[model samples]
Target: MGGSLPRSVDDLPLLPDLVAPQAWSADLVAASDGLFERGVRVLRDGEGGLLVIGDAVMRALAQDPAVGGTPVEFLTGRAGDRVRRATGAAPPSGAAAFDAFLRNQVFTMNAALHVAVRRVVARHLVPRAVLGMAGHAERVLVGVLDEVTRVGGVVDLERDVAGPYVTRFWTDQLGVPAGAALRVQQLVHEMNRMFLFAPTLEDRARVLAATEEYLELVGRTVAMAWERGDNALLGHLARGLDGIDLPGAPPDLGALVAANFFDGFHTVAVAVANAARCLLADAPAAERVRRAPSLVAAAFTEGARLTAPLMLTTRMALGDVEHAGLRIPAGTPITMAWIAANRDPEAYDEPGGYRLDRPPRLGTTFGGGARICPGRGATRMLGEVALRALTATSVQVRLESPQPGWVPGSAIRRHPAIPVVVRRVAAA
Candidate 1:
């Protein structure tokens, strides 16, 4: 098993120094593009790990559970312990429970447990179930666009449309009280800060606090659904848990529900904003989508490929694995640069441009294999509804700036607020 392969990922040639963080934010695609342009498929991540590019390598590693296993504290177990071990300080008060809660999350589970939980969750997000919600998504988006029409002028797409639309959709699905949905959304947002690449001590504390509140709300919502005998998402989860006969303690139903809901909600919100920004940046594409609604799905696919909402997903080498002529030592963390893989020149012709003609299943934006995001179908459906609704209107939408103003974070690609001018146009 040990011939000419490099002993460690660090032995691989490293990319030259990266630009400052602010510069990376200015052009989110530049850093990955630069690395890909230099023919650097593997490089040290500087955190004693490796960053991998190229679509084929990423897809292979992602599929092979023997090689790539989730190692992120946010996804796996003992986040609090890791923080304490790293900083030599006691973690937040709820850190232990929070970590335990995370361990039961679908992304963190392994083998049979992961399969069992995913089986329950995937049934709800399948094409049929997601299609059943299409009318709801369209109605919600149309209502938002109607409001945007009423409040003509400059509009923040993230704030005015994506945020509210996604929140409403999830809240309605989860059966949260109308008066409490906004607060639930706020709690989820706060809980999300813990995902930042290097969250501050304060951020960790806030996440723990927010997790408690979020779980409480979710529990109450699910209980209410059960009381009313409604088929809300949480109620379905509750019923689904009863049939699972996994070894060890029963899974934390509330944590599973909260984690899954937050993942779907947060990613979809960012995807909607990012896709909108991508669509608005290209006039001809938007007009094409406007003329042919069927093209909206392709537009969303192209947009997700270009924007890559979830940029980097990490995994630890479960065993010494050789790939692309280099050996990644066991225990070394591998960061799959999804954003870079999505834009790989070898994989796509003109990878940077947003074009709808790209064939289906072309990118790693939604991930691949076992961990391929189960919410992908829902994300595509909702994004298509949003783009279609925006195009169906007789309003002119123009970006306030050529480049999107991003939410300052190293974790995900998201625009905090996509400001645009929306002026009413005469009906044709």
Candidate 2:
């Protein structure tokens, strides 16, 4: 966990007791401004920790020649050397390995997206005849809805469903044994638990166990593809997993699974829920999206911009850097405040307003540069599917309670539970 700082100087006077005393220091405030000016990827002070802000800097670190094309590692307390080795160095590059990794990643991401879209379309849109697809979309939606209802109200949206869905889809695409898919699902669940839920030492151990199991499966799948001289499979896996260094890490499986989960499920799910909340709060916005299915993506993007799930990203200064006429010394910790940056008055017109048709403003939701999220396209597609389903259905969403709020201490903004009453509309 990291210390908290006020969103801006104006909020400094309201620092709560939970905020780290050091977070209110003058040097940190100056560094925050300097980070905005330099457009550097990372900013740090004397402490060597970092706040990663600028897209330019983020891109540079991702493509840094010094690391052989690896993103700069953000060093944390007592973990500098370990973190450096894990993220600061690049993977062994050979044509064969790199190609395979890339291909595998594409296949996995596409497969995951496919499942997500299908889930939404079948469950929400098809039944309502919103997209006019033939066949029994209603049956499919009913099956899932019935199952969910039977299972009770408590659903682990990320773990019990989305994680398993992606893992199964990915494994099937890669021709891996079906049994191993469960291990992947467990890995995904544990990682989400660790990073996004009640993070604890025991939770971490579960993550490690799941990771080991997944790696064994991935390793076997990779070897089998190679032995069969399957060029396509080899190339995909190589490219997808290329440059990932996991030496001395708790468990390679856990980290990789975690990465995939983060890329695929976490962001998209949160975005979907949050976007729905936004629409429900503003009737005009909801009507705009409902009237035009083509505008779903735009609406989602606007919602994301307004309430960026991630609050901040971190980076450490590798050396002294000058930004906006201020000098930031080597080893400083820099925090890139995404929530603030997305709302910057200079960057966004009517910063607080959510207008779907507005021109795209370059923002850091999926990050930028070499480390920019590779699964961004797929995630967007997933969001589109969810929106399409929700809008197509004639279910009226009424706020049973006050508008939902976000949970703190998370790297991303998340809605714990959105209690809304869904009443099916009478047939027109």
TM-score per candidate, in order?
0.88, 0.59
lDDT of 2 by residue, 170-249 (tens): 45434556677666555544544323222344443454455455455566664565556554433443444443332321
**lDDT of residue 89 for candidate 2:** 36
Residue by residue across 1-428, what tens digits does model 1's lDDT show? 11133556667655446545555445546777876676666667655677777777788778877654464363534456445654667666656546655666676566777788888888889999999999988777767777887878888887677877888887777776767767876887787776565456677788888877887787677567667866666667777787788863235565666667776667788888898789878888898999888999899988988887778777777787777567777877777878878888878999888898787865888888788888889999999888887776576777887776666655678776688876667888
Clashes in candidate 1: how many?
0
Which segments of candidate 2 are over 4 A away from where they belong?
Answer: 1-47, 50-186, 193-210, 213-235, 239-262, 329-333, 394-401, 420-427
Q: State how far residue 207 of model 1 sits from its true place (Å).
A: 2.3
RMSD of each: 3.5, 10.9
